[model samples]
Target: MVGWLLAGSMLAGACTASSPEVERAAPSGASEATPATEASSQPAAQGSVGRILEHLEALDRIAQRNGGTRAVGSEGYDESVAYVSRHMRQLGYSVVSDRFDFDYFEQLSPTRVERLKPRKAYVDGRDVRAMVYSGAGRVSAPVEPVGFDLRSNDHTGAGCSSDDFSDLPTGSIALLRPGPCYYRDQVVNAQEAGAAAVILAFPEFTRATGVLRPTLLSGAGIEIPALAATDGTGVELARSRTRLRITARTRYSPLRGVSLIAERREARAGDVLMVGGHLDSVMDGPGINDNGSGIATILEMARAVAAKEPDAPVRFAFWGGEEIGLLGSTAYVESLSSQQTTSIEAYLNFDMVASPNFVRYVYEDEIAPAGSDEITDLFTRYFNRQDIEFKTIDLGGRSDHGAFIEQGIPVGGLFTGAEMLKSRRQRKDYGGRAGASMDGCYHRPCDDIDNINQKVLREMVGAIRHALFALLTR
Candidate 1:
């Protein structure tokens, strides 16, 4: 899954609870149809829980052998691609290892922030740290606080607008707070206003002890350094009105990564049905539940359905660089000709499908393309038949689906949950701890195989298989 905050405006701020009454209704103006019976909806025997866990275990071992990460531009990611490709070939599917280039970022040294006038240096990784994609630079200048409302209860919306930096002097470090907008917008605004650097302050109400770590998403045309600060450090800098020195050393290199595309050797012609999930993990951890669950589920589905012939061609994609941005899927979509693009009838994405405190979630149809409601209904019908309750989530350009949606392709998918806290009502429906994050190990080093909820995984896999057959036959 993409980093919730790092992906910037591309992501919906957070997953919000859907109104149960509204979600359960059939799509507007569509006639209701009879639900499929068990005989018709049965999945392949190979699509078992044991088989999916075996795939996860293989991926876990791959990460363990390759420095505990499967992030893009890493050896672990390459191995992951090889593993999937080999499996697809064994299953008699034509597999393609599509390669693309991306800008890879690396921080070379410890970032430095100092109060020059007072001769005090703040601790690195505690009081200050460089934001991801920050340009390499060192500057000593006066610190100017821009657009701050220290007295107001709202701590957001400080440096979001260009007007906030209208009076900022050239070569000065602009001090600001996060949100009410993207971190990218604030940094870009400061850079355009001639500030030598930027310091983004953490919100006062946050209980986090360390400095904020945000991403500028991309470093194009950004020549100045950007840093994140603790709330205390920001307030002190604003009040003292002193000179400061900021230093950050970083590099962006051109690197290649691969996305694996697989399809049956004798796929049918006409409109194609696509199913996919991101394959790369964050540099932080193994990312077992963040995406390993999705990958394993889809791989098992591919194995189960390999022998069956569908009405339309089914393409399975394992996307790369989704953690940085939707690089692989975006490239794939952009590379397609108009005719090729139109041939793709719909896309189904599965990401983070087994949160420890899981909730059954279907992608909200309202925000997706025209034909997406049908896809949403397919998953909902399966869950409803199983007597399972589900919620709807609006994921705006957050995952691989965003690329397909850009070209007016209809898309729908399932998600257990990620990063957001489960409410008391959710606890009642799903039977998990209220106020705890749905996936407690999300994006952390603890996101290993043990982080997954096996019960949730099994249920989600059943729903996925049901929807897969329904779409193929229709």
Candidate 2:
């Protein structure tokens, strides 16, 4: 999954619910006891937790062989694609590898920020850090705070609009608060106002002890540099009218990524039930649990369903460049013709389904398209039948489903948890450390095979398998 922070507001109103009991017989040839659900009538397909773990082990070995990462633009990602595509082809599914290019940004050297008038050299990575996609430049200018509401703890609308910069002097460094809006908007507004550089400050109430690293997402047409500072550094710069010298060194290049799509060889044209997950991991880790879990689950489901075609055409996608953003999925959605887009009945996304400290989370129906409630009910009913407690999470544009949702396609999925800390109530429900992050190794080097919770992984795989069978047969 992408390393972006999960929205805190979404968690506050999360609902934990259970449905009436429904029994489903376990599929044949499954070693572990599977949930008995409404879809048990479709018994031709069988799920294997062992197969899922085997897939994960293969991905781990691939990552280990290729610098411990399956990140986009790397050999591991390419090998991952080869692995999945080979399996799909061997399973008698016709596969296509779609390629797309994106702007890749890398920092070439340490960024420097200095208080020129006070002769104070601010430490990089502590006082301030260069934003991703920040332009490389050196500038010395007086700082100007734009649209900052210092008194209020609410950090929103600052430098988000160009009107906020109307009176700002040209060549001045704009100091602004991180927003309800994107860092891209903030930097663009400052650039349009002829600012020499941009600095985004963490909210005063934020508990961050180090510099905040923000991303502009893209470097296309951006000329001036951008940086992020701690709350203290921001307040001092805003209050003291400091003249600052900023230097940022970065490189932007075009890179290609490929997403793999597979469907039955003899599949007919009709409404499609699309299921997918990002295949790429963050550069910091092998991403076994971050997404290797999702990939493994879906791959196993694909294998199970390969024996018999469903009533509706099913397409399986292994997306690329999701860690950088939702690049692969977004591009795929954009590439589809309007008629093709509408032909997609719904999408099921599985990302980060196995966290050490876990919760059985269903994507909240409120944020999804109209028919999504049915999809949500499908998983919840399965969980209820199995006597598993589940919560609804509002994942607003945080995963591959975001692309499908943008095209008015109903989307639903399963997620165990991510970087968010598990609550006391969640701990009671799921039985893990309450104060610890759901996935302690999220986006880090330690997110290897051992980072996974096999119990949650097996359960989630079962849930996903149940949901897929239910969707296909319904």
Which candidate has the top score in TM-score? Answer: 1
Score residue 34 of candidate 2 by CA lDDT: 52
Runs in model 1 deviating more than 4 A are: 6-47, 110-129, 139-143, 153-155, 158-160, 179-182, 202-214, 228-246, 310-312
lDDT of each: 0.79, 0.78
Q: lDDT tens digits, residues 1-474, model 1?
A: 774446333243545332231345444433345355432443432247788899999999989898888988889999999988998889888998878888777778888888987789987667887776788988999999887667877666567778888899988999887766678888988999999998887752123445434667677877898888878888888998799988889888778878999988688777889999999887767888979999999888887677565324899999998887778999999999999999998999999988999988888745578999888878887776666678777776578898998999999999988776788878988899998778877776778899888888878887888888888887
lDDT of 2 at 60: 94
Question: How many pairs of residues collide in each model?
Answer: 0, 2
lDDT of each residue in 2-99, candidate 2, tens digit only: 53322112221232122111223323333345555534622322346678888899999999999898988889888999999998888878899888
Q: What is candidate 2's local distance difference test score?
A: 0.78
Cα error, candidate 2, residue 395 (Å):
1.6
By lDDT, the best candidate is 1
Q: Count clashing residue pairs in model 1.
A: 0
Residue clash pairs of candidate 1: none
Worst 10 residues of 1 by lDDT: 16-25
